[model samples]
Target: MARRLCGEGLGTMLLLAAIVGSGIMAERLAGGNDALALLGNTLPTGAMLAVLILIFAPVSGAHFNPAVSLCLALRGDFPWRLLIPYTAVQIAGAIAGAWIAHLMFELPVLQLSVTARTGSGQWIAEAVATFGLVLTILGASARRPDAVPFLVGLYIAAAYWFTASTSFANPAVTVARMLSDTFAGIRPIDAPAFIAAQLLGALAGLAASRLLFSPDAKPVAG
Candidate 1:
């Protein structure tokens, strides 16, 4: 349990750092238009998450995202007792990472709001983006643990390109992003709706996983 907790904490911290650091760099490098900037941000996020999962999956099951943890619990992989702690640590890590990025960028650039949003179409985009993410994680990793890291990284990269929401699937990340005034932040007022949509999408992914991956399949030993 201690090992799992530590892995979760470290993974979450790395996740946030990659997000904020890459976002800051992207903004600076991309100038005004953010296309190249987003690529800069997401590519490192995908790579780092893959590395973290590879490094920590044996210890904490590598659930860097609270939503991923919740879904895995529903699938009967994770212990229910660890849920709150895991989520709390993940959120804290995200906040700390954002704070680090703020410090690195020297405050002025960090103070500039970089939160992103889309029109009503974006709500649907968020749903589909999250659904694809959860589904991919479950199919590629939870159900088939051998492929966890690589497949997850590939899925994230694909989701970033295909989804309009840029596939911000984790609620903790959504909340942490709000603290940063940088390109990675989410507006506080808009967060709840995006989070709700992500949860619903996760549920859909769970159902799909149940249908597609047999419950009788052998569980991957942690």
Candidate 2:
């Protein structure tokens, strides 16, 4: 249990660090080119996601996101008893990671984001983004467990471009980003809607996974 929680915390910490740190770095280097900065942020975040999942999945299922953990618990892939602990640690790790990123960039340890990312479209985008992410994780792990890391990475990379909200699919990630006044930050006032959307998407993804990859399906007779 301890090891699993540690894995969750560490994985989430590293994930946020990669996200916030990359955003800061990209903003500095993009030279007013939003596309270029986004591209830079996308590659590292996707790559780090794969690496982090590969490193931690064997130990703790690599659920760096509360949405993933919640969805897995709903799907019965994760033990219900560990859900709260996993979520708590993930949020803590995210906050710590944001602080780390700030320290690294020599910015304030905490700053409320002014970036207004609210509205119906962004909320809808969050729902869709999270649904796809959770679906990919659950679906891939059902048949090709070893492919989960890569599939999640690929899905997020694509979601970054396709989704208007930039795919803040994880509740923990969304909350943490509120403290960062960077290219990746979202306004605190907007987080509740995003989190609500993410939770809804997680439920939708779990339902979809159950329908698409029913665990009770019997094998065909020879």
Candidate 3:
């Protein structure tokens, strides 16, 4: 249990660090308009997620997102005892990661206005983005665990491009990103709506996954 918790904490830390750090670098140090800088940010995020999954999936199932953990629990894959601690740790790790990014950039992230989508259209975008994320995770993990990391990375990358909200799927990430004044932050006022959309999208994804992928399906070994 200790090992699992540690793995969860570490993975969540790495995930948030990648997100907050990249956003800071892109918006603050790089002047926010460079396409290459944006790419630089996304590349590392993908790499980090892949690495974290490879490292921790066996131990903690690599549920760095509270939504994902909750969904898995609802699906009967994870125990109820794990829900609260996993969420708390993930949030703490995200906040710590945001703080680290602030230190790295030597900027006051809290004072900066959040950068995220707003309005009904934006809310729709968030739903679609999160729905894709959750669906991909469920599909890959349920039927093809070996492809989990790659599929997740690919799904996120695609969602970032296709979705207007840029795919801020994880609630912990959405909250942490709001703390930064960089391109990644969402205004606190905008957060609840996005989170609600994400949770609804996750439930939708769960239903979709059940229709598409059966629990008894065999995963191909890499």
Query: Candidate 2 on 104-143: residue-level lDDT in tens?
Result: 9999997999999999999999999999998898888878
Q: Enumerate clash totals for all models, in the order shown.
A: 0, 0, 1
lDDT tens per residue, model 1, 1-222: 777777788788888888988898999999887789989988998998889888988788888888888988888888888899999988887777787777777874344344667466667777787788788887875466788788888888777878877878888888788778888887777778888888888889888988777667676579
Best first by TM-score, ranked: 2, 3, 1
Candidate number of the best TM-score: 2
Provide the lowest-lDDT 10-residue window in model 1.
107-116
Stretch of 10 with least lDDT, candidate 3: 108-117
List the candidate 3 regions with Cα displacement exceeding 4 Å: 28-34, 109-112, 216-222
lDDT by residue for model 3 over 1-222, one digit each (tens)? 788888888788888888778866665556556665666677778778888888889889998888899889999999999999999888888877887877777877455445656998778888888888889898887767899998887777667667777788888888888777776778888988999999998889888988778756565679
- For each of the candidates, the C-alpha root-mean-square deviation to the true structure, in angstroms, is 3.9, 2.1, 3.0
- Model with the higher lDDT, candidate 2 or 3: 2
Which residue pairs collide, candidate 2? none
Question: Where does candidate 1 stray beyond 4 Å?
Answer: 108-118, 142-144, 216-222
TM-score of 2: 0.96
